[model samples]
Target: MRLPIITFGMALAFCAVHLFVGRLRWLDRTPRSRWLSFAGGVAVGYVFLHILPELGAHASTFEDATGLDAPLAEGLVYTLSLVGLALFYGLERALALSRGERMAREGRDRPHHPVFWLHIAASALLVALIAYLLNHREDPSAAGLALYFAAMVLHFVTADFGTRADHPEIYDARGRWVLAAATLGGWALGLLVELPELAIGCLFAFVGGGIVLLVLKEELPEDRKSFFLPFLGGALLYAALVLGETYLAAA
Candidate 1:
């Protein structure tokens, strides 16, 4: 009962967080690596501790409903997740290269880039759709939803860092609005569209993989200067929060 509203609020909260990061002065003064590391850790932790377990459960349902062997259904979903992960990784790499080439060729400060807009447009849709999925669950609780909210807010923040690095002017002026609207749009879609059990399972599996790719791509760096303590601590804290939720459910 309360969970769905909270989930919707969290979705809106994500948009608000993005807005603040884009316009506010606080994060500008902080060491971004520490914040980014924490975000990446929380995002990864949510995928492993919460999303994967739920995916496993949904896989069984998928098998039962689809007349496929349980193992086969699980394999298919996992494959989808891997494909999603690889697809996004490839997109990010390609976009990076393309942006570099354009910058080198132009030899001037470019205020706008197509790749940044394309990437954020796609990312915004994904984020919103994921939020919609979260709320559409048959039985949602406030605690579980709160964990997702905490994780995704950080996740989006990490993403914003990349957006700002690539195109600060464009992102500040328009990119944030697109993402915020997408969050609300996703909630609307969830209310209007209902997916079959198998379909829902597969969609989430896909998202699970994408989450892994996005986080690792940022957290792992060639220079090896990525902060580890905040990352590790955030993961531990989120994991504890998840475990506490499970315990509360059981008790």
Candidate 2:
């Protein structure tokens, strides 16, 4: 009962981030906000320091549940992570091409209407999956949940900014509401359905890969003029927190 309530609270919080991100005018800048870069760095830290390691730890559990050959099972989660990264990379490339074509043909710089919806739908799915995982985390402790929530809140902030930039005309009008609803829907789904540990591991792996790709994509673009110092500060701060949590747990 307590866990569900906590998870629900987290889900609402996640939804709020999407719904209210537009109010963060500081993030609306020609050169990307240093804070957004910092958010990206925190997300990257979470993925590399926590999510990937958890996937590795769960590999054996995945094998035990599925009874696959040890070698195959061991490599499978990592492979799925790669697949997740590739999937998002491909999506970004497609969006970029659409934007370029539309700009050249119509003198507008956004994806086709259909492509814009597709991008929003995909983004909604990603947010939903993250919300679902809030209930089924590897570390369900208060500290663990706090770490996950902080990283994700920041990640969503960065994501919302990027998405809005891509489809400025439609994003504020419709896309944010879609993402917010997806977050709550995911939490409700989590309450109703308990997936197997193996399935959970796979989902986590895929999301981890996607996070890595998404964060890097936003930060690495030359035109964005991302701030390196804030990014580094964010990464280091998150890494230290994660390490401290690990040490306390082990002790």
Candidate 3:
């Protein structure tokens, strides 16, 4: 009973971040906020420390469900991870090219309506998967759930900033709503339907890959002028927390 209540609260929190992210004007800046960079670092740390390791641990379960050869079954999750990363990378590149072309033609740097919708659809799907996973976590401990929630909330801040930057007017008007709805809808679906372990593993792997690409894209772009020290601090802090949690669980 308490777990459902807590999960529902987390779901609402996820939706709130998307719906209200535009109001955070401080995050809009030329040189990117150190805090956003720090958020990205924590997100990356969670992917590396938690998500990826869990995917590996689920490899055998995936193998049993799929009944593929050992090698293929073991590799499939990582392959899906790469596919997710590449898919988002391709989307980002497409948006960049479209924005450049639009800038050259109309003196506007944003994607057209079609491209914007396409991007939003993809983003919403990712958000939905994230929300769904919140209800289907491998480790449902209070500490684990809290860590996951904190990392994702911070990640969503960075993600919302990027989306809002890309299409400010449209995102505020419609994109946020779409994502917020997706978050809640995903949670509702999770409450009603439980997927197989293999399916959950696949979802986690794909999301992990997407997160890595999204976080790195923001940090690695020189034009953003991202802060390094804050990023490092965030990564180290999150890594310590995760390690401590693991140690305690083991004990």
Q: Best TM-score goes to which candidate? A: 3
In candidate 1, stretches whose alpha carbon ends up further than 4 angstroms from where it belongs are 1-4, 24-31, 108-112
Pairs that collide in candidate 3 are: none
Put down candidate 2 lDDT per residue, 151-196, tens digits, no spaces: 9999999988888888877888889999999999988888889888
Give TM per candidate. Answer: 0.88, 0.95, 0.96
Model 1, 99-204: lDDT tens per residue?
Answer: 7677788864342376667778767757876677666663377677677778888888877766666677877888888888888888777777787777777777
- Give the Å shift of residue 46 in candidate 3: 0.7
Once fitted onto the true fold, the runs of candidate 3 whose alpha carbons sit more than 4 angstroms away are none
lDDT of 3 by residue, 137-160 (tens): 878678898899999999899988
Query: Which runs in model 2 stand beyond 4 Å of their true positions?
Result: none
Candidate order by decreasing lDDT: 2, 3, 1
Point out the worst 10-residue segment of candidate 2 by lDDT: 1-10
Scored by lDDT, model 2 comes in at 0.87
Let me know the TM-score candidate 3 reaches against the reference structure: 0.96
Compute the lDDT of residue 27 as modeled in candidate 3. 78
Cα deviation at 82, candidate 2, in Å, is 1.4
